[model samples]
Target chain A: MRLGMFFREALRSIRANAAISVAATVTALIAVFILGAFIPSFMYVRSAVSAQTSKVDVDVYISDTASVKQVNALRDKIGTLKTDGQVAEFTYVSKDDALRLMRERLRDPSVLDELPSNPLPAKFNIQPTDPANANAIVAAVKDDAALDPTEGIVYPQTTADRLLTAAKFVQWAGFALIGILLVAAVLLIGNTIRLSIFARRREVEVMRLVGATNWFIRWPFMIEGVICGLVGAVVAVAMLWGIKVGVVDAWASGADTALTKTGSAGGAIAFPLLTVVLVGAGALLGAVGSGITLRRFLRI
Target chain B: MARIDDDIHDAGSTPRAFTLVEVPLETVPADLAVVTPPASEKRRRGDVFRPGPGPMVQFQGVIKRYDGDVRGLDGVSVSIAAGEFVFLVGQSGSGKSTFIRLCIRELRATSGHVIIGGRDLGELKRSKVPYLRRAIGCVFQDFRLLPDRTASENVAYALQVTGHSRQEVNRRVPEILALVGLDGKGDRLPRELSGGEQQRVSIARALVNQPRLLIADEPTGNLDPDTSQGIMDLLTRINRTGTTVLVATHDRDTVDRMQQRVIALHKGRIVRDAEGGYNEDPGDTGEIA
Candidate 1:
């Protein structure tokens, strides 16, 4: 028999079972949607992790009574921090500058002028090369007698701890959600294509009896499964992009200060590539699911 | 229409074995098995395409069974000449269907070689089964025509299954349909036709490829005497076309009346072989056609 004729017959069989095809498509759509929902959640979590990580720094307050030579020695250490692999940034503020900043923050314009001989101390602001070690770097600075009670050290320890916890939570949660969606997506398309194969088992058996090749029988279903998955992914991406742009952005721009306080709450969803990955992945996942179902039940 | 033989008449038939009378018609399953050709008369139509001989169908000491232990055909063998017509008759479950199925490679012989047209059916690859079947036209008693397809479609399907292009299939299907007396019924589906017509459609399917060997399994077992005569006439006409015919049936009327080579089988062994008088016209000897 003609290869073209057999494929045409297969296409006709698939068409005749319109209800099954639609059911499979709907199943694919839902499977892909569930998978797509997890994509942006992962991106948002990643973004949160990065934003929180960027806030970590080490602060070193110098004593006003320190010798000029000692202060200059510490300045040299701060300057070589990058090459030494100890710090990311170093900012130094003199006693006069510190008093002026405190005066401004204290919101008493006359406080700096009233201070006797600039009571505030000079300080070196240090940021670690890695956010993870910011607290350790601060502790090290404070352990030094001259940098301890005399000058003091400051670090955003509480905020860093909280942000690290949030980041870890997001990472684990996103990973766990992705794993579940993968299986669910496979099973979703698997059952759908299984029914598709079941619907055409008669034709399949006929073709088998007639000596048609296994690939000749299976390629169409594989193709159909992939196409169905792509459609599902496309729908999901559109929905995700719409939620990201039309709704989230509009809300962010419209006096949503409270929403913005969650560290650019809506900005984390800009991931265009991630959406493509999710959609493209859905198609691949569909192919794999089809492979399983066809292999298992199509008995090819 | 092309004129066929003169002896295919109702009164010219012979005794039929295991008719509907024997098999209770009170109520059978929906899938009524219309197995026509009985598998008696072991004629090993000699080696086909021998480097020095004409084509033949040959079987050498063939044994067959289902469970590999229960004997189907027990060490039986025979040779049949090319272009000869023969009939096989035996009791129910006497390995008639098994014999033909073995020749077609639908079932393999346990201990023998079945060779046809220079190709060994036993040794042919699984993929080559269709190609092998192309040279052999098989007609079932139940008329295994696709019920959903029209008469021409049913005939065309046989060719289509053998890789005939649309042009060749369209041409040969009509010719064969006409040959089977289904000329104008090409558009009629199997169910739309009478039982005899359905069997004729099957015959048309069998004849579509212009096969060298026509294996009919009770081609008319389902029809009444009159209708059965029509079917026998069709097969005889097919046999006259220089094609070897192997018919397995218990309808002694069609076989004895026709006076073709009769190979009688009793419990899987040949009991009778009437030959040489094959071409003697029934009219000259007062015998059935």
Candidate 2:
């Protein structure tokens, strides 16, 4: 019953002060919309980078003079190589399989037909369970002197290094941008709630005089703020859904870009999860902003 | 100066020894006896006027100093019995508002003790201030009604905030409105009512909780002579029903006409404390007689 009264009072105040209410709701919608748009893109970029890194492996080529028994033994040893308790998997490709793969990748089979013999060597592809452990796996392979007959290992060090740098930059920049925007949203909501409460300070004084406890006087205002936040979040989520379906999907259909490929690979945040996060952030911002603002005005 | 100091000291010592001043029933006006609650219900509620030996309000050498070293109440000591209708009369800047604010615990006294219903306000925690205020009804000159709400809602709000049941609020709002002589005006908004009617609504709001004490700070300051008289009569009737009433007013005519116990202040000091009309003597300085 008390909660009902509080909500009634809050709704009444919201209607009475329409301009301030709209300003606060619109500010919250814009802020939450920006946050919603940024987070999925950030998640998508992170997943795409990690997917590229996971494809990196060390290739151990077998020497032509090495016996089949030696090659099998080296493969067994590479399979046992583990980093952080994660075993490496070895895929042994024969010389014929390598030649076949190269032939398929090449646009013209006539150039490959000019060679006197297949020049490609049989290699074992060593993959770590976790991409972050690739360096440790490579070090272990290099330390194995028993595999001396094998050709030198080939690890894409430059590509790995560049991917790591890009991931770190994106993570830090995403956090900084979200932090600035969240602060701006909080300040705008707080100021609007403060103004709304200031206009009704006389009513608050009367409530206090009539023996209303501090919480009793504060509940309505806080609930009003939460309602504003919830409305903004719902609107922003709807807009985000429209953009995702209309803009992003259309662009993806028209072009085969890297982003589209990543999207097809399921690199984006799930819509349900994104909606929950955006709505939760919006509600939290609204409640906290109004709660803090009421503290200064309602001294009862 | 020495005589004046002695008189102030004498008034300060009266409450310490628990002196009760009995005013005969015939001395009160006959017209103030219209509405009286039944004796059985009054006893069940344990009204403050249960022939108790203790004073309802006690101030022991209270000193309240504002910012910039200004004195709001300067070493003032007085006591009000449980059922007394006392008038706190003074000109502007004379500590009347300060005295009332201290009673409600709105402004803490810088020194000395203010005890209401046998509880020391200084020892009360900040969280308990609301409960303390609940025991005292306060009516202000500006009425302080929420302009957006009807008079009944304004009165029901007081009961609602104190956690009364909705049915109880519905039951009691009209009763209190009737008691305050705003019987049919419950549906009217504050702006639609006259200044006097608004003040009555404020008074009804104050009295809805059946507080032990009612403190009116110039409740009729904005009303004309006739409306002010009606408000004073309502206050007198409310007092006669066993609720202690303290009125601080600049209306010298009403104070003189009521002829209740008047406690007058000048420059934060109590100049006179006695059963009388408003003190008009210019030569008298802090003299009780």
Estimate, for each residue in B1-289, the C-alpha lDDT of model 1 and write its tens digit: 2111111111222222212224343333222222111233122221111211345677788887667466678767777777688887666556678788887777888888776765566766564454456557788877766555688987776656545568767766766676667768999978899999898888877766556778988887888989988887767655654568998987766776777887666555665667522222222222111
Tens digits of per-residue lDDT, candidate 1, A1-300, equal 455675565456457667776776677677666766666656765775767677687778776567778778777766766567878778888777887688778766775576567667778877777787775566445554345365487788888887888888888888898888888888888888788888667556544433334565576677677767777778777877777678867876887574356455554554676677777877787788878887764342
Against the reference, the lDDT scores of all candidates come to 0.66, 0.80
* Candidate 2 local lDDT, residue A210: 76
What would the per-residue lDDT of candidate 2 be over residues A241-288, giving only the tens digit for each residue?
A: 999999988887899887667543577788999999999988988888
Q: Among these predicted structures, which one has the highest TM-score? A: 2
Instruction: Output the chain A TM-score of model 1.
Output: 0.76
Index of the highest-lDDT prediction: 2
Once model 2 is optimally superposed onto the true structure by TM-score, how far is the C-alpha of residue A174 displaced, in angstroms? 4.8
- Which residue ranges in model 1 land beyond 4 Å of their true spot? A1-7, A50-72, A84-86, A92-125, A128-145, A149-202, A205-300, B1-93, B97-116, B121-123, B133-149, B152-165, B206-210, B213-225, B242-289
How high is the DockQ of candidate 2? 0.57
**Candidate 1 chain A, poorest ten consecutive residues by summed lDDT:** A205-214
**Can you give the lDDT of residue A300 in candidate 1?**
24
